[model samples]
Target chain A: MAEAPTNPVALAAESTVATRMSAPPSFDVADFPVPTGREEEWRFTPLERLRGLHDGSAAATAGGSVKAEVTTPEGSGVTVETVSRDDARVGKAGTPVDRVAAQAFSAVEKATVITVPAEAVLTEPVRVSVHGEGGVTFGHTVFRIGAFAEVVLVLDHTGDTVRAANVDFVVGDGAKVTVVSVQDWADTAVHCSQHNALVGRDATFKSVVVTFGGDVVRIHPRVTYAGPGGEAELYGLYFTDGGQHQEHRLLVDHSAPNCRSNVAYKGALQGADAHAVWIGDVVIQAAATGTDTYELNRNLVLTDGARVDSVPNLEIETGEIAGAGHASATGRFEDEQLFYLMARGIPEEEARRLVVRGFFAELIQQIGVPDVEERLIAKLTAELERSIA
Target chain B: MATLEIRDLHVSVEAEGGPTEILRGVDLTVKQGETHAIMGPNGSGKSTLAYSLAGHPKYTVTGGTVTLDGEDVLEMSVDERARAGVFLAMQYPVEVPGVSVSNFLRTSATAVRGEAPKLRTWVKEVKEAMARLEMDPAFAERNVNEGFSGGEKKRHEILQLELLKPKIAILDETDSGLDIDALRIVSEGVNRVRANGESGTLLITHYTRILRYINPDHVHVFAGGRIVESGGPELADKLEAEGYEAYTKGGGVS
Candidate 1:
């Protein structure tokens, strides 16, 4: 209950890490034991459904399963290269903290490094499209932005495959980076990924994760400030249908002075056995003074059989911070909203669609991409039509 | 002419312990072009009659028969009742966040009129109506009742009444929290629709203030969940002078 200490006096405190993470960050995959369904981090996950990605039994059986392509505009001073895992840029942002991420790091055959030089502002977005041809794949990608640079990066996934990937972002001082990762895989696909961001002094980092399809998906994004005055924002949106499991776990480590972090994630679930899990952890260390942070998660359950588990954990070790807070809410379709719409001569089905669309309107606007927004709106309509049918 | 007939209407709402009957064996009739005011005190079930007619799911009809021009109103669903020309201007309109007023009105108009309204004319009509209500053009972009003050909520309800054009309009305490200016504007909106002689107005209120603007053909004193006395427009003045203390003392459905 005691959070957000404002003054810088001698306040007795102890800096700490989240107890949910049983192991510390390490580069070696052997350091982490294979997760069962019982560990704190894996409690809500259906470990058996991860297609052997958790226990290291799954292999790259299908060769052409996933094809990766990166597009950069002409003379943009951006370089994209496919290098071996020994590349100097590999793991520059952060190391793997869990089994799936560590496994991807140790087994990745090649790493893709995209570099945006200092002070170069991009006029067009750098687009990466990962097309799943079939089977299984492992990948690692590093994005390093130079100081005072600005860029909008979009990564899109499609088709069917079993994948485990590690994506790292190294943001330079005073740089502004916006990353949008869309997990729109086929219903038969399985995906587990770890995203790491090392934000520099006075830099701004924003990442938007959207998950719409897949039998199972678990995404872990960790953030650590490298210098003072940095800011990080993590946003996520998911829509879970019947027999699907989607999970997002995030940790924002405010390690430097005057750094700020904000996180928000929203989800809607329908059909029987649909499950959504959101775990947000914010830790303000003892030396990180003047830190301001807040996190929120809201879930709208559309049907009876769907379930949602939302947890917001805030741990402030020092009593000399500026502000810290978190909130989580899970509610069903509001009967009052439904009745209000119905009484306006709108049918039940149309009224439902309107309410659901309105619920996601704010988050969808954050994408800032016209074509992507239009596509999401169309996808939302299609998702609603399934229930109506 | 459209007519709404309510006979032996009994309604109950779920409470802490169990179902508690609110409207007990009430009878009333409202006809097109007629404004009937049902005056009562705090717990006399005035709002119950409005919600029951509007087919709200919260209030259950234990025993009743409601008919609009000889069609069974109770048999229809909420939206069906609206399409059949029944409307209730709720005291506390529900907040629908992110649903802009323009979008809500257009959708409602499309549903009631069975087709989308012509854009140019519809925009003109809405703009003019909002002007008459002294509402700013920017209000159309605000979400429905999301952060509206009391007066704004009442005005929005009346705006819907003007646009939807239901044959049977039930104004439940529409003047409860309005200032004099708002009361006058809302009253004029109701009168404009009434002048068409195509809809009946059932105005339920605890105070006689709004009746001064919108004259009622009949004034009914309600107590014990039923109407105990009926008279002409002068009855409103009489009740306004003496108040409903005499009628509600030992007169409620205890």
Candidate 2:
């Protein structure tokens, strides 16, 4: 059961959470103090709009307003369980890196664990849908895959509420997994989440994060390899409309030898006050010999008064790595492309639509889900019509 | 029969300082089923003429009146010009990422035809057009003009020319950056369209090599942004034998 504070103001007055820290990040809420928009990690984030998730001012009440439903494929040898916070497998995948994530870890009483057996291949995708019924909620979910297991997981968020959650993914040796997380909340909702993935030896992990709705949404996805020969691919696509704030922060750590990582994220912003931010970070340690990594971010401003901030950072301690590079570009629709399309007899409005559809087509096809791809295309078309209208 | 009439055309393009004149008081006309070859040296404003007729935004028409079958040509928008039966085969076709050639051709056809083509016949039409261009069938699925070789791009332009079937077609340097084989193939496509006897062709080029393939009904030697000489087909042979130096002396129009 989840809880909500009756008087938010009183809770804020009683809370004495530290607002500064000079040490490394830890899972404990007290260890990593609440951010006051001064820290490097929290500089871009709007502290006041967090709904008190950062500080312990928003106490939990037994409301259970957010409901989560998990559906596994039939005969896939998958099991789902609800365990206490003290469960041994709770924090094996990753530890929290920020105060909000730490607070989420301390708030959720029961954590959901979904496990796939070793050497099992799922023919159908597993789906987890979380629907918000109002109020505030905190959640934690863990996905554990055994050695050589192959699975596709789809996590969907919807409805209107304030939410702070943490999701952990643990991939065993030689396992292959694809996770598609979509944030399609109501226009009045606010969501903050941190996703951590740990790839085992020779394992392959692919994560696709698609954000389309929500008032203020921030998602952080981080990856780290436990052994050599592991490969990770991170892809993201987001659309921000008027008065919406969407942020994506990603990190890939290559600590083991011969590991590889590639990241590409693209976003389109429209209308006034639409802001989209992307931060890509790749760190290659001294022991990460033969490490190869590349990151790219592109933003398309569809209309006036929209802003995008794209930052790509790479740190290499060893020159022995294979390769490391990054690129960032932000622009509006190219006039040349518009002219080319129009010179062929397509009307101005239709040509504009086609150009934008083409911009997102490449990434949409990479999703590999036919139904989901079609839905996204339809959504994008509707969004384009709204912008024009 | 359709007639494209140009009267004292004057065009200029914006530069760092101000508006720089490109086409200065030029006049040309083409009747249906006629191929008019405009040959000139570099910087002779030959391409500017082609672009001006197609109504490019970069080239401003300061003083000009172009009429296509008695309709104002300069007043129409870029796509409106295309729908009104005016086509331009650009020298450097732009690349449109994520848009397949098949989709682009169909969309263009739909806009010009005012309705979607029948699925069964449209597929056959595309297949036949690609085959006639000697293009591999896989190219239809590739992005429009993306990573296409120079020859392939020219062939693609021809493919559109054959499909769109506009009343007036302006080929701007269509022969440049092409090998002998590609030149022959592209020329044959143009010849096929000319054989229809329903569209007028305005071919702008720097060399007379392509004239050997597609014999023009009229030849115009352009110098100093205006036509210096106009004659029959033999004028091309004379110009090819003797370069434009005879027409251009002391950088003055003869």
Candidate 3:
């Protein structure tokens, strides 16, 4: 199979609308068919909350500098450009996501395009920091890793603001990409983000999203293995405190043969009104022979009023696959695990934090970038300290 | 110094049919610097005795007094007993994924010793212990017992026993799955623990191969949920020569 051209004509057609770049991608909710709330996929998603998104000046109100910087073992890099706008091409993704649609438009209208040079192996990471100040806002980023290259991208969302962010990544053939997004906003921030990745042939892509700061946080993360032998792994770790609602929905599409995809997500929700939801869908196509895939979602709900809902789905259309399996579980901390740690003289709180950290550490170690892993650890520990506080 | 005594012990397990007494009216005592070997055939309750001594939640002790250094061991939780200087090298150690052996040993050591060891000293101790057991030092980073061979698992048990020094270490069939090389290394580790002079040991085995390196001060024969015979080191040799056929044929009742 030949590699996808540097500039695909189909993708180029959408770029022509760059001239009509508006303030924000505007779409009347009535322009699209109303989901009767009957679709199996849309059943659980709160449709009413989306009404608050539409007809609101939230997207236009988004104005703040996202201090984007990239630091590697070698040195730091500068931000090339930050594009914040809604691209109509993203809305035609043929997916029924009421939340993603408005956020996609709002994100495409305001996107930060960061392009790493072709075949350039940057030893350092490219950091894009998105900062929002007061009102409801949106931020988006498009990261393109050139073919046969390696790069680490860290998206740090901070500041005292309630906003939504979209992050899209395109990994070229034989390229290796590691992306770590730290959603560490102020406690009062409302963060809704989308993370999408397209991995090419023989390419390796890893995404680690940590949601430790936010009021109502939802991450729509999707990964598509578009070429054979590509490997895609997505890991999400979220720790919620009191009165926080965090949801993570991930979709992995194995479109080509022999591609491998794995998802391991863990979250801990504590205190009153703490709620978390994890939805994972792994689709193995008919041509994806010899595809080995596995997904596991484990959540710990520590408090009487806290709730966690986990769903792991494996949809295989072909029997020629090598292996496929998924597992999901949500509950409070294991007394046995806790006791095992406490018996070691680790105090109760320290033991619980250790277990939670260990739970997410398993996924963090899979991120493959030492810098990203350290940042995640620092961010996660900071959140843990605050939660225990 | 220290002493571990089980007086008139009665242990029962909830089997498919009902509760069946596993250890009945068994009395044993071992003082510091002494190693006691309990040899028995299948279903003779040798492992049950070890579990009962370690306070495994599965084994219910109906009547017994298990005292470690004059402290009631049966009254303690499994981990509590361990913290109170009681260790059980499980016959079949459970494989825990995502938890490294070194991490588990550190946690266990901290639990038993009531504080974390100095990082430099702890690393040195773990390396020295693993080295003493003929284990690859790299094994410390591998998941606890996950994907380990039979000999490796048994050695891992010995690894914990060496790290978590106890007043009385109960090794349930430690020699069951070990190869001659692994068996020798495990025996050496056991001897090193005893060399400290502060820890007694209960070495449970079906064969006497391990007895060559570490001879026990006392040998007890278990048959039908009770210790039918008690003798010195030669008894182990006699049983190794004739097998448990003679003991069972003698028809000792519980």
Global Cα lDDT for candidate 1: 0.87
Question: Which portions of model 2 miss their true places by more than 4 Å?
Answer: A1-23, A55-64, B246-254
* lDDT for each residue of candidate 3 in A1-389, tens digit (9 for 90 to 100): 12332222111223322211222222332343444445444445454443334334455555544454544344323336644354432322223244444554533455556667667778777777776566666555667777887888887877766565566677788888888887887777667666767788899988888888767677878777657898888888888787777778887777689988888998888899787788887777677788989999988877778878788877776899879999888866666555544433345676666667776767888888887778778877777787765
The digit string of per-residue lDDT tens for model 1 on A1-389 reads: 00111221222333233455546666677898888778888889998888888787775343535878899988999999999999877887777777888888888878999999999999888998998887778899989989999998899999988898899888899999999899998998888888888888999999989998999999998888878899999989899999999999998987789999989899999999999999898888788999999999999999999999998878777888989999999989998988888888998899988888888877878777677678788888888898655
Better of 2 and 3 by DockQ: 2
Q: A107-133, model 2: which lDDT tens digit per residue?
A: 888899999988899978889999988
Once fitted onto the true fold, the runs of candidate 1 whose alpha carbons sit more than 4 angstroms away are: A1-17, A60-64, B249-254
Worst 10 residues of 2 chain A by lDDT: A1-10
The per-model lDDT (C-alpha) reads 0.87, 0.86, 0.73
Residue A296, candidate 2: Cα error in Å is 1.6
Candidate 1: chain B TM-score equals 0.97
User: Candidate 2 residues B82-101, lDDT tens each?
Assistant: 99999999999988888999
Docking quality band of candidate 3, CAPRI definitions: incorrect
Q: How would you order the candidates by DockQ, starting with the best?
A: 1, 2, 3
